[model samples]
Target: MKTCNNCGAQVEDVAKFCPECGFKFGSIAEPRAVVTDMYDHTSEFSPEDIANNKLYAILMYCVSLMGIIIGLLAAGDSPYVRFHIKQSLKLFICEVILGLITGALFWTVIVGIVGGIAIVVLAVVDIICLVNACKGLAKEPPIVCKIGFLK
Candidate 1:
């Protein structure tokens, strides 16, 4: 048996690609392997790949921009992208909930100063997280903005 480099799943030795994860295997030459390696590196994404994967990248770029369903769908077949998408979704949900609560408090009880301050803080944190995502970093949002329910 041979292990799939992508997902570490074992497959029959005669298999040219991993059945579970679809990772191709067994190149005949060093040049071919090098080309394969280049494509496998996520950080070295080409413009075409980025364009093709634009929805996935955008869904991952802002946790509060869309629903978790969209993020999950965009993250298809890529664990690294999925990780960021999931994290962003969690942060987005938290920001939404906080915004609603703060708005309600300000409008219903006239606690305008405190509610406005809370909203400002949440917006700043959300912007920071979005900026990080645009840079393709997988850093999680601040602790207060993360949804513990999913993690």
Candidate 2:
């Protein structure tokens, strides 16, 4: 038997995850063990990596405007870029659908006004995520997006 580092529960030595806290038993403690204050995993990125990969970072930010094409390109190597690209693709698709629906419902000043407002909000969020990406920060966008389908 071995004591789990996470919750101090006794578990079999052969167990992979702790029974009490589900912490992985052996390979290495989760990053949470070292960086306990933050809840987001993106925070684990090293600053040096972000600074050196500015091009990839910018590509991820611009993915919102280019849609799936750019997103697919960005997903090639860098996991950081891939994460942002996936998120931006989701937001872009949602915005497009919303634009179509609103245009159909109210093809006048009202839809334009509301849709424009929504676009601005999304743009600002994209900008923020982009800036964070540049800084090598693992920050997700404020917008709710689904990238589960992306590999």
TM-score, candidate 1, is 0.50
Which candidate should be chosen as best, given TM-score against the real structure? 2
For each candidate, give its TM-score against the true structure: 0.50, 0.55
CA lDDT scores, all candidates in order: 0.60, 0.65
Q: In model 1, where is the ten-residue run with the lowest total lDDT?
A: 32-41
Candidate 1 per-residue lDDT over residues 1-151, each given as its tens digit: 7677778898898888789977777653125433343112345444554445555655554534453456566546655556556666666676677777777776665567776776677667667766655655445566543345665
Evaluate residue 75 in candidate 2 and report its C-alpha lDDT on the 0 to 100 scale: 48
Q: 86 in model 2: Cα distance from truth in Å?
A: 1.1
The all-Cα superposition gives candidate 1 an RMSD in Å to the true structure of: 13.5
Q: Candidate 2 has which clashing residue pairs, if any?
A: none
What would the per-residue lDDT of candidate 2 be over residues 1-151, giving only the tens digit for each residue?
9889888999998899997889887656544555543324466555555555556656656655664455456545656556666666666666787778677866688887888787788778778867876666765566543233432
Give stretches of model 2 more than 4 Å off.
1-40, 46-49, 63-71, 108-112, 145-151
